[model samples]
Every structure is written in structure tokens, then in C-alpha cells.
Target chain A: MSAVKQFIPLFDRILVSRAVAAAKTKGGIMLPESSQKKLNEGVVVSCGPGAVDADGDVIPVSVSVGDKVLLPEYGGTKLNLDDEEYLLIRDSEILGKFVKVTSE
Target chain B: MSAVKQFIPLFDRILVSRAVAAAKTKGGIMLPESSQKKLNEGVVVSCGPGAVDADGDVIPVSVSVGDKVLLPEYGGTKLNLDDEEYLLIRDSEILGKFVKVTSE
Candidate 1:
């Protein structure tokens, strides 16, 4: 892991990198690059303490770093850092942590 | 309200309509159409029963239909029905439910 990926998430923010396309369609759509559209699935690089609840208490996010998370395709801000595009999304926005399946 | 918007949610899926652009920048990027990119801030159209938890029980999502939700920009499959693009996102993928504010 690089030093940039070693930072801790703050509040409820999570550091994520878009998963490259597994394969492109025959039509050459190229699965819109991260610059063009929000890509799903990312390896959690960092996480925040938690989100504040209505009671003013901290509600910790369920997932942890190194987990592959699924999220909605429509939210989050796009940002570029170190020439690589990454997304800083809230943990609540994540749908679920995918369990890796190894071929039998 | 349209009849299509009156159906009940099934498992944990929430039907959503993309929130239209609040304001478009002059660059003509057009924020990538719903077909090109996943759009954020959808009005919940329907919901599902809930996700099955480790305990084998249903864990209902927090928000309800009519709720305006924020999502991660990077995840979700694109689909179009009846000539309208809509997102069927898992509630867990939703980041937060926006509380409409009435300014004085």
C-alpha cells in the first residue's frame, strides 16, 4: 500500500478508489471512466469516526478499511489527487461489503 | 401521482427518480445524462421488505418512500423503463435522507 492510502478516515468520510472495469462492452462504451460517471465498488482506504445521530451521539459505520463496498451509482463528489481519481463518500452511502468468492 | 409510483417496495430495493439539476454550469457538461452517469438525490418511489440480517431476520431500511436520498456517485446499474431513466438502489446504498428546509 502507498503512503497516500495509509491515512485514516475522519468523521464519516471514506477513501475509495473506483474499480476498473472487468470488461468493456462490444459496442466500445468503455464503461464511462471515473471522470465521466460514478463507478461502483471500491476498496476502502480509510474511514471516519462515525456520523452524528439525532441524539447528538456518534454512530459508528459498520464496515472497515480493506473491505470492498458497494454503493449507489448517483452520489458523491468527484476529485483528483496525485493524478488519480478517488471518491470520498460517506459510509452510510455504502450499500454493502461484498464477500469475495473463490472459484471451486 | 402516477400509478407506477404507487407500487410497494419488495425486498430492500427503493425506486428513485433522479433529482433534476438545481442549476447547470455554463460549460455545457450537462452533468452527464441519466443514461451516461448515475445521478444523485432521488425521490424514493418504492421500498422493499428489508435486508436479511445475520440473525435471519429482516432489517428494514431507515428511510421511506417520498424521502429524498443522497447516494454514492460510484455505484449502481443503469436502467431505463418507459422512456424514463430510474434507479433501483438498495436502501443501504443510500447515504442520507435529505430534510427539506423551509427558509424564512
Candidate 2:
């Protein structure tokens, strides 16, 4: 079974996989894996449909799958699946998303 | 000026006044002021129009003015208005409402 199908988040919850440190920078600067600084970032692995409002309306989540997002230092429930660690957090708890800058 | 008119909570927020200790119980038992037990209770003073949903619909608050409610041990923004202390909290933060029981 696929990892995504193993468990599904509910009610505006999101499953995120923390970003791993890269050995090289985007500018081609080489750095040792141990020397690479870990950032509070993650990619949206899966997300719930959204939370229901008092009027029974579905409030869609702002982030989508494969989106890179910035996470808080704390909060979110940690989960272990297939020996990999992930975080399940509410959509509202997410700080923001990282938008790619394209220079024309 | 009336206390209620002084400040109006907005967006599902409620203004509450903590219940004061009474010298006597509802069962007519007499108790000294110092011996009276304080409870995690409050009376709703004012409520906001309600929070707006994604569709711009207003979700009415569950508790109304003069409604007795159970409060959490902590939370709610404290305010001192005209020498009186009050708590401003979201309606969702309230644990539950105390309904008056009537005997036929």
C-alpha cells in the first residue's frame, strides 16, 4: 500500500514532510551535509478537504499538495509511517507558503 | 454610561463577567463570605455579531447575553473597564453553558 493511502488526515488537517538539508546551495555553493543549516520548511504531502463552518459550509484549505510551506518551530502532531516522520497540523496553524520568484 | 455600551466584542468574541461568590447557596444554606467557594463560571455580558464564513455568512454565537457559561482556567483577554474586571474570549473557548433547571 502507498504511504498516502495508509493514513488520511481529516478536517482541515494537513500531512507534511519536513524538507531535508541539501549538500549544495541554489547558487552552487558546496557545503558539508553536517554544516547545512536546517530550515523550518516542509512540503504538503496530503491535506483534508477543509473544516466545516457553523453554517455547514466547507472552508477549503489554503495550501495544496506539493506546495512548499514555512512551519512554526513548535506545534503540530508528529506521526511515524513506514519509518518516516511527518507532521499533521491544522491548515490555520501553518504560517505561510513559499512562493517561487521568477525573474522575467 | 452603561458598561455594556462601553465595549462591544467583535467576531464571535464574548464579554464575560466572572461569577461572584454568594453568601448563600440556592438551597438556602447560609455561608460566610470568606467560606464561599469560587467556581469557574461567568455570565455573558455581550457578544459579537458572529464570525464571517468563507461565503461571507455570519455564524451566530451559541451563547447570549445573561447566559451562564463555564470558562477555562486560563485564556481570554482581561480588561479593566470602569473599575470592573471582565474577560473577552471567543465563544468557542467556552466549555459549556449552564442551563437553568426547572421543576414542575
Candidate 3:
């Protein structure tokens, strides 16, 4: 992770490291790694400021570094750095972000 | 075409009627209709004012009504009106507009 800090994405592009799949299901049944369903979730490692509009004004990216976001099923440039795989995608391609809720 | 004037697209969306495939090649060799390749080109019938940005400012669409534009091979909602087929697509999805070049 330390080496990843040196890189920065450009122009509304986001760098994401996919979350690891759960070994067990909600029912507590252990599943093999191969059988585990690949989750479309990831954490934002790096993100650009935003895309520029026709007028040259910047349209800032909605998500920031450390945000947990939902990814599309496909699409995104795959990258490998120091044996770790990462996905580079446009900020608009992100479906949504996961928000944590706390009871009062 | 007059009936098409009654309908208007909304919000960066453009209503396009695809161009007909040419029955003859540029070389002037005649071909059957079934043998002609489908063209990814269309004429804009109607267009939206523009899409609103996050700040609520309207970002006007680039293309105008009657503009000859290139279309993507896929994506876009299909519509049927007055026995004619039209496609509803976002302005951003358009690849580019065709310009007529005339020698002075």
C-alpha cells in the first residue's frame, strides 16, 4: 500500500483496489475461494480532482480517497503494480457509495 | 416529418432517425438492400436544451436539430412513432457531427 501512494490518477480517473471476497456466507457456511462470488466493491485508493466541462470549469469527482464505492460489473482499465492489481475507471462509472449508519 | 415536430426530447437527450443504408458503394457498383451494411449515422430530429450539472447550471448540448451525426453501434432507447422508428440517446453518446465540406 505504501508504494501505491506515490501514484496519482488524472482527470476524474479513480484508482481502486477491489475488496477481498468473504470466505464464509451470512449463514456461516464456509465456501472455497474459487466458489466465492466476486464482489463489485472496492475502496478508492486515488482519485482525480474532476472532469472539465465545455466551459473549462472543473466538475469535481463525487468520491474521494478511502471512500467505499460500488463498481460496475465490467469496464475499467486493469493495472498491476508491485504484484498488486488495481482498477482505473472514470468517477462517473462508479454506481454509488456505501454509507455507514449508526443508531442514536 | 411534420408529425415528428410535435415530439420534443428532454435533458441532453436527442431524438434521431437513422440514415438509410446506401444501395451502391462509392465505386458505383450497385448492391442489393440486404447486402448493404447498416450505417451508424443519423439526423437529429429533436434535442434537449441541456443537462443540469450538480450546481443546477444548465450545460447545453452541442448538437442541434437536423445535425447529421455519427451514432454509437449500440445503446440508446428505441422508439416507434407514426410508423417510423427513432432512437433516443444522450448527446454525450454521439461520436461526432458530420460537416459538409465545399470547395471555394
Candidate 4:
């Protein structure tokens, strides 16, 4: 969070860190980087002020910090910050927020 | 516009027709299909009702019908309808509206 704070998103944009593949398999065998699949899931790092309308009213974005979101297969602007890979995407490009399923 | 109405967008989504490269160059030299570069510019054909907030409030989108917009280099769901290619992309992925300058 500290590192992501240095860069802020603007104009209904969001910064996200894509998820990495599992380190080990079900058999507890370590996997190689080449075998790791690039995940479309990401964690919301930061968000910009919501986009303004014709009348100049600011609308709040649906997502917030710490929310997990489903990303479009393509379309994010790749950026490297603090040696970490991040994406600058407009909130509209986000497919949906991954809802956490909590058992009763 | 008649054909685009067959499909409707949802949640800040917009339908756009990507610009096609000219068959002839400024010098009047005809170019082959292989030489055509996919343009990132598009014209807004249709748009979804604005995304609703958690409070269920609908926000109006910035761009309207007939607006020209700059699209991300990559990212948009491609669909073919009535022999025409269109993209379904969130309005956020749109870089900006192409403003027309009228000379007095």
C-alpha cells in the first residue's frame, strides 16, 4: 500500500496489481515462472476521483481500495512502479467486482 | 444507427465503430489490405444507461451519440453485426472525446 500511494489515479482511473500464479501445485511441487499463467484478477490499489458529467457533477466510482476486481483480458496501460507491475485502467474497463462469498 | 439499435449496452458501456484506414493515401496511391493499419479512433454509436452506484443512483455519461472518441490501443469486445464491426467497451476505456475545431 505504501508503494502504491506514491502514484495516484485520476479521472475515474484505477491502479491495480495483477495476481500472480500459485507457487506450488496440489502435490506441493514447486512450479516454474513459465508455467505461471497471467491472471486477469487484480487488487485495487488506488482510484481517481469519479468522472464528471456534462453538467460537471462528479460521480463516485463503484469500486474502492482493497476491492478485488475482474479485469478485461486486454486494454490496461502497463506501468512499473517501485519495481512492481501495475496497471492504469479506467473504471469502465473493469468487468466487475469480485464478490467475496462468506458462508453463513 | 438503425443497425446499432438492435444491440443495447449496459452499465456505462458504449458501442463504437472503429475507423478504417483509407484505401488511397494522400498522394493518391492505392494501398493494399495488408498495408491498412487498424485505427484507434472510433465514432460512438450507442451507449448504456450510466452505471449505478451502490445507492442505486444513475449517473449520466459524458459523451453522447455522434461523438468521436479516442480508444485504447488494445481492449474492446469485438462483434460483427450486419456485416459491420463494432466494439463493446466501457466508457472509461475511452481516452477522450475528439473535439472538433470550427474555424470562424
DockQ of each: 0.03, 0.02, 0.02, 0.02
Model 4 ranges off by over 4 Å: A1-104, B1-5
True contacts kept of 4: 0.00
lDDT per residue (tens digit) for residues B1-104 in model 4: 35434877998899999898799998999999997887777789989997776667776666788987767778889989889999888876776554544443
Q: What is candidate 4's lDDT per residue for A1-104, written digit by digit as tens?
A: 12212555546878899998788998999999898987899999888777776554787888999999999999978866557998878889999998778998
User: B70 in model 3: Cα distance from truth in Å?
Assistant: 31
TM-score-superior candidate, 1 or 3: 3
Highest DockQ among the candidates is held by which one?
1
Interface RMSD of 4: 15.7
Q: What RMSD does each model have against the real structure?
A: 14.0, 15.1, 13.6, 12.4
DockQ of 2: 0.02
TM-score per candidate, chains pooled: 0.43, 0.45, 0.49, 0.51
Please provide, for model 2 over A1-104, each residue's C-alpha lDDT reduced to its tens digit, 9 standing for 90 to 100.
65554677898899999987788887989988787755667899999988888678787776799988766567899999889999898886665565544443
Question: Comparing to the true complex, what docking class would candidate 2 get?
Answer: incorrect
Give the i-RMS of model 1 in Å. Answer: 15.5
Identify the superior model by TM-score, candidate 2 or candidate 4.
4
Instruction: Say what the RMSD of model 3 is.
Output: 13.6
On the 0 to 100 scale, the lDDT of residue A21 in model 3 is 79
Give the higher-TM-score candidate: 2 or 3.
3
The whole-model lDDT of each prediction reads 0.66, 0.79, 0.79, 0.80
The regions of model 3 sitting more than 4 angstroms off are A1-5, A26-28, B1-104
